[model samples]
Target: MTGTANRSVERAFRIVDELAENGGGRVSELADRLEMPVSTVHNYLQALVETGYVTVEDKEYSTTTRFLEVGHRQRHRLEVFQAVSDELQDIAAETGEHVTLLVEESDQCVIVAVQEGPDAVNLFAYPGARMPLHAAAPGKAILAHMPEDRVQGIIDRQGLVEMTNRTITDPDALFEQLAEIREQGYAIDEGERIAGMVCISAPVLDKSDEIRGAICVCGPQSRIDEKRRDEIADIVKRSANVTQVNLDYV
Candidate 1:
């Protein structure tokens, strides 16, 4: 591809993402957010509209439903997600806790699905939301199983940035925690990423013994006290195992 084509593609995607973030936007708004000229944004928006990927009304542009249709088509192809669908729903129903399945993407953990609990308050997890692997329970679960060299590589690229006061900031301490998580086959976040938020997660492995993702349960500190922590951890571990077994069969 020519350099011009590559840049055009990048700029087009930036407009798409920025439009999504702002919900609906004028060409000038998108141009300002992307630090590009309005003419460039207008040209890309026109192209996207012509391709039926975007819609415009009253000088405001927004993505079309085509994106969700494409996403649904893509989800149908991921057998791993299908395998754990029922189990995730059941776990959330029984425990009345927020459950999430996340996969590693670009050295970060991206939430693929979420089942909100009966409780009113829930973790702010959305499909495609990315969290640092060093900060979240689900991320730690996958990170723990990763080879030390690979884990180090991720840590090097995405330094252990602190999200909360309790977050593990020291590299050595974080490594130690990963070791413990590996031995126990589960990972825990003690108000690390979000204040008063506790999460327990277990890794979901594929048929080939590769870490595909993780199953996580999120709760408040009061609910996940020491006594219930083990209980929730055990539940999460079992759920992950069930998903893995189902994946193997699929």
Candidate 2:
């Protein structure tokens, strides 16, 4: 690209950021903040206003409602959100427990979607939150399905920081648990991430058998007890399978 085009793009972004940070900005104020000429700032502001991405009122420029429209459209377009939206609600309703979808990102568990049960407790986790990859049931479900190199990289970078006494602090023990999870097709977190909480998770796979993500049911130990462990795991496994099937169809 030409130097003029690159510089214009940079100046436009600076103008937008300056306006956003200051709530609104006049051409002179934007120029002062960005250390660019007032005429250049005005040109970018006009372009933004004309494109419907920005608006001017009382000679001040700011972002428009177009951003909200873009955000809503982007949320609906997410593949993971589409795959799990209805199923998470169904799983929560069926099991009477919290349902969550987690994906592995940078060796950590990132919550992508969540559905609370009727008797919801004060869960610390939520969508967009990150958790250690060695503690939660959803984390184990993801780790067990990850490639060996990826698992090793996680261990090297983020040594399993024990959140509770039950959390696997030893690398060898964690690997053993992952092996068991692989064999059983589900993982269990019995007061591991948080005391008095038990979570059961199963891996969601794609058509290529690659790990897509994990689904979990979380509740207090009394509700997710020893007698109900397998039952909860079976339900989780079913939901996971349905997610994969949905992905395939998509």
Best by TM-score: 1
**lDDT string, candidate 2, 1-250, tens digits:** 9999998888888777677668887888878878888887888899999999899999988988786677557546656567775888988888888889888877889887789888756697766678998999999989998887789889999998989999999988988899999999999998999999999999998888888789999998977767788898999999889888888666
RMSD per candidate (Å) reads 1.6, 6.2
- Candidates in order, TM-scores: namely 0.94, 0.71
TM-score of candidate 1 to 2 decimals:
0.94
Which tens-of-lDDT digit does each residue in 15-45 have in candidate 1? 8988888898998888788899989889999
Residue 230 deviation, candidate 2, in Å? Answer: 1.3
How far is 141's C-alpha from truth in model 2 (Å)? 0.5
Clash count for each candidate, listed in order shown? 0, 0
At residue 142, give the lDDT of candidate 2. Answer: 91
